[model samples]
Target chain A: MRVALDILIWVLFAFVIIGAIPVAAGAYQFLLIPFHSFKNHYSKARPHLPRVAVLLPAWNEGAVIGNSIERLVKLSYPAGRLRIYVVDDASTDDTPDVVLGKAAKYPGMVFHLRRQKGGEGKAHTLNHGITHLLADDWMEALLIMDADVIYREDSLRRMTSHLGDPKVGAVTAYIAEGSADPNYLTRFIAFEYVAAQKASRRAQNVLGALACLAGGAQLHSRENLLAIGGRIDTSSLAEDTFTTFNTQLGGRKVVFEPHAVVLAEEPGSIGALWKQRLRWARGNVQLTQRFHKVWFRPSKVHRLGSISFGLFWFTTFLLPVAMILSSIGLIGLYFLERELASTVFRVSWFLSACTYVFLTLYTIFLDGPTGRRSWREALLFPGIISLLVMIMAFAPGSLDHWLPGLFGLQVTEVGQEIWTLSVYAWLSLSMVAAWLVKKVESTRIGRMLSPLLIYFVGYGALLCAITFDSYIKEFQGAAQVWDKTEKTGRVAA
Target chain B: MSGVHRPGVVRAERVTGVSALTGLDQAELSQGEATDRALTDEALWREIAHNRRAELRLVPEALLALLVVAGLIILREVYFR
Candidate 1:
């Protein structure tokens, strides 16, 4: 009982430490931004708006690029001042043909460029555009955008206004769901976007630890970008994170301008949304590993301000541990020691409830006064999904093998390939366990939680096996890459 | 580098020696130059060689890092104790 009590107190202390980080994060919404907003007002005392380049990277956007370009071109900036560069990454469709057609319509307004045929993907395309195409002196401000995104006409002006302050490296405008009538999956994700952008992005900005600017539509200076590195890490799957980290590494502040808004379309169907989010999660996992060196050993300039990037994804792997602890707290409450169990149960519930509330409120706060989210709606997000959504998002896909293969090799193989013989053993036990545990909550839930213990920790162990076994591989030292999600939802009338 | 405006009426800005790709004078390369140059199919692009190391650009991302460290320190001091 004495040893158990000691362990119990230690566990509670761990929970408090874990919960406090985000609570400190939440303090940003209530306290930091308002203060920073005022500081921004003061910085405006001497303004210097550089000529801005709205760089929208697109491939096969024939249907939407026209409108997206027109909307951006018509932005309130001086007529020719706001230039639009759309990198056509070797699309098989009439993307280049369509772009040529638009270039005729908006003669000097829209600039059309193409990537080398075999050398495709956003990072390579961006690197090619920035280095070979543009003379560094001229490309002052750059806006990174997906092909399907649309933006307010005044968006450029507001973003440029902030650039006048030399300290601001990158500015991310508010990204909202372009289609309200999107599928249910899209709707839930849309709310999540608003919450994420407002609460998490806002909190991150306050803490000065912004990991990446949104890829949809964000503005940065060319000179400043080149100073750190021209086009962010082209090798990493997550170019957005690479840019965000580099921007912070440059010691330039990244800001979220709520007033500056853009409408970006997201995947509408379940299959499509899964692909989209999986790419995001996997890309996050990949980038976290790639930039772990920078994040873990951040230079003096951006020590704490930069950790949130790694922290966000790194902590995700810990969610399962936290949930298991919660389960333990409940089990202890039920059978162990009534008083001690009550304490553990109440304490766990309180810490978790507080985290849930604060995270929800921070997101709702980003909704501004007219946000669609209510206190209740935000409260039951994960619970209402009944953990199915959690499994869908977290469960490692069979497709992870394809990811490393995309760079041209299967050498650094993990789990599936590495544990082939071990897998046979585990497979037999898993099948038996599945048959026995059908009535218990869910098998998918088990898959979700099981991988947390495995994902980074297990993936790492498997990679070590590959190296030790001298596994034959492809793409020797090339960066492992993943596919960008195709946005299927179209703008409906 | 994907957003490209459709090629409408190709209007060269009646200049002597500008890029024939767009033919527009003072056509900043960031928009057309980068896109137009990326037309090659087999060029092996090198990642930015690390010749430059945070050479004190206008805004230092380092200050942001320092701010983060300072913030962490403050958090630990205030709460961990």
Candidate 2:
């Protein structure tokens, strides 16, 4: 019995160390973001503007189609040079009529094509548009975009300018959340987008290999598109990611043009966000399967095969699982021995908090108003998620109740009580930190309290719980459904 | 916020040597130049930022801060008692 207990403790310790590896690496990467931003060099020059075809894929997008079409037609790019092709995927709504109306306004420039039998998917709609556009040899570049996304006037020009360099195969603009009436969820997403686009994408640009290009604003050169066989892939829910990899695989450089900004409406509710992110999570898993060779034998040819890109994707997929296991293991370890567990958990949590603080600061500094105004979203970053997971973790009827029986682990009554209390205590502390950060600001006491608040939130362990749930759903061969983020035509210009 | 013009026509002022790819294998042709430029630029920036440790300069600082803070937390939890 003694030997078994000792062995179990050692295994738990090993799990904690193994789990800390990815979290530490992620922290280091976050630390690298600010310096990368500082090194950003911009040069102003008149770029060669190529004849571009914009492929706007629509399906029941009546709410935003008119605005999107108008925005595209009024783009700063020359009317004769920039052609808008809206492929309406058999929408029962007035999307077709809206596109046709716009097409009439911009005669010969904006054209609308409707599929008789539609609703296959966005990827199919894009492919339908791509096929028709490829027939016209005059188009030097093609912009694959959605019907709901509104691009800034110079966005198309900035994206097209990258094509001036022949080495550039594709360029993607940053997609900012344009929710007119901001809710907590949308605000959090807005902050997340800043971190993702500003920090992560910039770091990727510096590395010369991007993890994935933004779906809304991808500009592909005609030649490179042809090299990849001229159709948007329909094999994965993440067709944009598929296309991004294909461009790199076809020996062309994909660039992230940050200056080109596009505003998109994101899901505003938790349920909606969950559905949307689940599709993305599942698509990533599918991407891993589809591009297994990229991992098995990484080479220069497949840029996705490169170390930075590959590790980033792999770690992102596995971190949640690792985190969940480690968290549970630590809780269990704490029940057996308090001092041993406290040191490990505190250290890991502290490192994660550092990463979180650095990311929030850099993301806020990079983007202006949205970052500053929505800064409170950072406090709730993982705090809310952590609270949810803690409730789930300790719920009487949930998975925790079955743990002892399922794992055949010996837990004294006192140990179990202590473990539950400790978890709740940690969660309460995190909530308090979040509350302080959200309520207190710019005061002397606020400044003093800020670091501890930042420390308490750490990498919201609840995010890991969410990811783990997604992982299980994907692993169970859950149906791959495109849960579209419902758009309300409420975007801030 | 710019003026619209004709398609496929490059204006005199806008036209530059880097306007478009001249070769059929434009993708491969431009790879060497872009890669070399990016690599050299990255190196220079790294050296200027912090010689030999530019990219990871913050790691040590963050790690140290984390350690010191975590040490205090652990001391409060365990050693203080």
Candidate 3:
């Protein structure tokens, strides 16, 4: 009975941690500088005649869906062969009209439809489209996308050809900046995305563990998708991620084609980005519960990577809270052995210095070849990477209304009001206290420390570690999920 | 992992072959649906067997066994090592 109980706990632990792979992946991609050049090999490559459709999911996105449709219909592939379908979820806006305009211009090239009554969300809308597709008789593969995602003419062709490999279940395309003008946050996200979509996901494909396809530009077989379920969960906000991993559950692969690039707008404001991240975080916490059993299957190498994904974040999420309290205790001990305090500070500074230098070199290399950042920008990469995560952790409402969605039906949890500001008032206050103490304490070590360390050590270091571990895991095909930090970008084009 | 259900059911045995394949990797092409049966005669099966004989090499499990041992050692250190 005791042995059985131990096994049960192990299984439970495995399930909880497996989905954590993606979160750690985001962090990993952020930290690691890649040595290899990332480019599209499939852009110019053709494949044996494979039927493909560009399936677009739109939700009240009248403003941008037209641009997306016009852009998609103009793709350079064989006009008669390639298909486009846009399914609009119940929209109060002129979204349907915009889709209809494009449908009229392209005639057979673009297919437009509205969601049926009782449709819950994007997932339901997609399900309706998948079932309602006229080309089901001819279409072999489906390219799932959002309303806002605009693909280059060659993007569709490159993504579809990769699906020819039986081991590859889905292909997620890379996101590049579409417009030249971008805010600092958007540029940061774009560069961050390139690092992830290329450096990390490619490495995962090398190992056969490519994680989830990006919702913006995912390509897969109609048969494989139908096998999972006809549609994503419209009831929830994170249909893309849910659908991606669920496909893996059916014994299919998820991949990234970095060269099949799509340009997307970044979220405009930090607050807007935060709300987007919350949706992702809630979805991830929810999915972690959904796919808990996948980890216990002994035959799958994915289970191992999945667990590492979770463990890394669980450490990060739990560690900062633990470390801050521990540091307080350590400081009290400093009275007894201030020498230990001296040593600890010195070690931290040395580690921080070494890590920053290593990261700067990688950024310089990436910047030199691709003009990813200006010289001054690349020079500030490490400081910004750490500073951003630290401030983000203390950002309002991050963990405010997570429990209800996170715990699902087992716990009756409630989400926060839209635009609920000041959610992190208390946590931020706590952070301020830690910072003040470290600042005022004229003790040997605290005096030498920078205010930046409080931000980095208390928050950024933990997130950086989490991102690194996940990026490596996902790059290697681990399906574990970390939340996407939704920038102020529209999903509909 | 299981019994073969039928010739083209569990794994679709490629019947028709594209005589001159395009950018599709040749190794993956055998799994594609070809309309012609005579194209996939015994010789092609033998070819697929040669190409698909092995999978990506995996690290030996012995290292994993040692990791488990090290985990045990670490646990012991925390308790009674």
Candidate 4:
């Protein structure tokens, strides 16, 4: 029995180590960002502006469609070579009117295509445009974009230039959250994008295994699109990811153009953000199953199956599971061996603290303007409670001393033991806190308290909670409903 | 045409018997010349230079971050123990 318990303790420690892998992977990804200059495909890129067709899929986007079209028309590409096609997904609003008006105004540059039967999904709408564009020989490249996003003047030119390299199939731009008057939620999202899109995608470029193209700012060469069946994948919720994987699997390179900036209006509330990310999380779950054979199975065709890429993918996919398992391991160890549990907790969290500091600083340096604006959000990404836990890990017993001293109290042995156990349990408790943040957001005082709850629980924890929910929904075979995030024209020109 | 005027090049023709052109004409000429300058060899080289400089700047910062992390770990090991 003693030997068995010892073996179980060692197994628990292994789970703690497993949880640290994703944190280490995140830091590693950021460390790879500077090397992008050497490994990127820019050497093969040139200023090649093909006859480009911009596909905007709109479903009742009247509020933003007109402004979006105006911005597309004013893009710095040659006026003759660029065209806009807005696929109206049977919008009940004045979307068709706005689009038709723009079509009339821009004449040859803008055209409106309507679907008599709509509400199927974004993929179906995008396919409708793809079919129409492919029917003609005029378009040499296709730019897939959301209706609410505003492209910078030189963005299209920068993106299309990569098509100059015949081997490059697709290009994705840096998508910045562009809510003009961003609240707390948008700021958090903005900082998250700086990390996810700007910093992480740069690392992906170096690895030569892009996980997914930005759904709102993907540009594809016509030949490459036709090679991948000429239409978007309508079966999965993650059509963009499917297309990205298919493009790479077909023996072509997908490049991330950091200079090409697209501004998108992200969700402004917790409920809204939850819905948006839940869809994404579910899609990721679907994709993981769909491409089960591709992971960790190296192929001559693509690097999607490479060990490094697979680690990055699975680490992110299984992060919530890892967090729960780590907590369980620590708690189990505590019952068997208290000293060992304490040491393991300190070591794991110490690694997490290092990752937290390195990634926050590196992300800030990656984009100065966004770094300046969302620095607060960046700092509090792991949540205030997690931050305290990190501090406690860094300086063992310091929090016990300082926190009690602040309240003019002494720490008893029992209280200290309980506190230690609480810290061990916090790994999973943070996810619970995150779910409570969503619950609070739906309450009468949601608008007032939810943001505060988020700061206390942390945005990263919130995302993990959403991913956990996705795992449940997928396991239970929930119906895949296309929940479109309502867009307000908050993006600045 | 043989010496100065190439197929894709535009040369000044001593307008108003003066070698120097007016500001408006120069501006117009620069606008036409801009197309040639777009994404030229010099521009691509400039982009490469910028990337190199960015990489150089980042290396020191990344190194400093590494040192900080190492310092924290060392401090915990030495002081806490």
State which candidate has the highest lDDT.
Answer: 4
Q: Which ten residues in a row are the worst by lDDT in model 4 chain A?
A: A42-51
Per-candidate chain B TM: 0.30, 0.33, 0.29, 0.44
Candidate 3 lDDT over A1-493, as tens digits, reads 9787556544433432332333344335433212112222232222423556778877667767788888876664445445788887766778788888888888877887777562365566677778876333556677778777678766775565556566556778877645446654454455456445554565555444445567777777766776776666654456777777677766777766655678887664433444454455455555555666654343363432454344433453343344343344334334434455334433332333333333334433332333345343333434443333222333222333343457662322223321121221222233444435344434556544533343333323323333333334434654433233332335333
lDDT of 1 by residue, A298-411 (tens): 566774324544465445433333333444444433343545544543343333334444445445544543235333334444433222222221222323444457788565
- lDDT (Cα, tens digit) per residue for candidate 4, span A1-493: 9898779988998988888889889887888977875777767765465668999999999999999999988776556567899999999999999999999998988999999999889999999999999897778789999999999977887787677778889999999999988999999999999889888888888888999999999999888999999999999889999999999999999999888899999999888888889989999999999999999999998889999899889899999999998999999889888888888888889889999988888888778899899999999999999999998888887786789999999888899889878888887999998898898787788778988888988999999999999999999989888899999899988
Q: Where does model 3 exceed 4 Å of error?
A: A1-49, A116-119, A234-236, A295-298, A301-337, A359-493, B1-81
Q: Give candidate 3's error at residue A343 in angstroms.
A: 3.0
User: In lDDT terms, how accurate is model 3?
Assistant: 0.50
A202-290 per-residue lDDT for model 2 (tens digits): 67776667778788899988888899899988977788888988888777888876767899998764446656776777777788788
Report, to 2 decimal places, the DockQ of model 4: 0.14
DockQ of each: 0.02, 0.07, 0.03, 0.14
Candidate number of the best DockQ: 4
lDDT of 3 at B41: 33
Task: List the pairs of residues colliding in candidate 4.
Answer: none
User: Is 1 or 4 the stronger prediction by DockQ?
Assistant: 4
Question: Among all windows of ten consecutive residues in candidate 1 chain A, which has the lowest summed lDDT?
Answer: A465-474
Say what the interface RMSD of candidate 2 is.
13.1
TM-scores of all candidate predictions against the true structure: 0.63, 0.75, 0.60, 0.92
Count of clashing residue pairs in every prediction: 49, 0, 29, 0
Please give fnat for model 3: 0.01
